[model samples]
Target: MNRLTLISLQVLVAVVVLVFWHIASTTTLIGNPKTISFFFAEPLAVGKRMVQWFMEGSIWYHLGITLTEAALAFIIGSLGGVIIGFWFARKPLLAAVFDPYVKAANALPRVVLAPIFALWLGLGIWSKVALGVTLVFFIVFFNVYQGVKEVSPAVLSNARMLGMNERQLLRHVYMPSALSWMFSSLHTSVGFAVVGAVVGEYLGSAAGLGYLIHEAESVFDVTGVFAGMFVLMGFVILVDWLVTLVENRLLVWRPKTSVISNR
Candidate 1:
């Protein structure tokens, strides 16, 4: 479909959903308004709350905190993953030695680590950053490792025949090959990074969107909870869009696939 058609469809879907939600909450289409307000919350109330928070300038501080944690986690985890992935890929013995341990760490649910991190790092933003890093690290690491391992032997042999040293080979061959995989993983890692931060904050934090949601839940303020969620969803979408731009710019040399229609 063309871009305009795609966008129109998306907007139509959103409008339909909102209308249904309003009917369900304001009218007795599904349940009483009171009951619906108690549970699902009225969309109008949620929207008003979101707007009020924005107008009062109370959201920026919480939004900034979450964004900072996510950005730090993404940067630190990705760099560490790329470096370690490259090292392990180059050293078969090292990779073999650490394989089980790496698997074990990745298998452990990150939620279980939140309280431990909170205790160690306190309720500050660093604890959330640490949690996000753990979630992002494994994603990028595995992708990079696989990318390097998947390099064609013929390509390696041809490069070596041209007298390319280890550094030159890495610069011209390995880095580029692994970068494609790294970017692919990054798209996924961005969401996980946000998840980690929000989960961490929900578990324990002085300030954050997650904290706001947790507070609303404690008081059974469903509208506030929904407002917080909508804000978070918008933030994630913005971050994902920025990541897409970076990916497109960096991977411009890669082949593009077009969808052809048969009429």
Candidate 2:
């Protein structure tokens, strides 16, 4: 679809959802309106609460903390994932040796690690960053590894015949091959980075959007809870938009037959 058409469809979907939500929460559409409102909160009320939060400026500090944790996690986790993925893909024996261990690590439930991270790092941003890194690392690592492994054999042979050394091949061939895959996971990585930060904050923290939600939940303030969630969704969308701009710039030459990204 064209950009305008796609956006129009998206807006239509949002309107439908909001209308349904308003009917369910503010009127006797689904069942008792009071009970529904208690559970879900009126959409208008939540929107107003969101506006109040931004107007009062209390959310900026918490937003900043969450942003800091996510930024650190995305940077650290992506770097580690790319470097390690390259190493493993280039070294079969090394990969074989660590394959099971890597699988085991990835299989572990990340939510289970939140409290442990908090205990080890204290109830601070670092704990949140650590959790976020765990969430981001596996995604980028698998993509990068597959991108390198899927490099065309014919291209490799030609490069080898042209007298390129391993280091030169890696710089010119492997890195470029992996770039598309790396960028393809940008949105997912950004979302998970935010998730990790928020989950960590929700579990235990002095500040963050997640903390705001948790506080609201404790008081049975459904409007506040929904407002906090809406803020988080907007925050994530903003970050994803920035990531997309970077990806579009870097992959301006992405080809139709590129094996690096499914796109």
- Runs in model 2 lying further than 4 Å from the true structure: 1-6, 256-263
When summed lDDT is taken over every stretch of 10 residues in candidate 1, the lowest stretch is 254-263
How close is every model to the real structure, measured as TM-score? 0.95, 0.92
Tens-digit per-residue lDDT, 1-263, candidate 1: 89999999999999999999999989987888788878999899999999999999999999999999999999999998999999999999999999999999999999999999999999999999999999999999998999899989999999999999999999998999898888866678999999999999999999999999999999999999999999999999999999888877887876655101100
lDDT of 2 by residue, 51-162 (tens): 9988999999999999999999999999999999999999999999999999999999899999999999999899999999998999999989998999999998999999
Error of 2 at 239 (Å): 1.5
Model 1 CA lDDT for position 140: 91
Per-candidate Cα lDDT values, in order, are 0.91, 0.91
lDDT of 2 at 97: 98
How far residue 174's Cα lies from its native spot in candidate 2, in Å, is 1.0
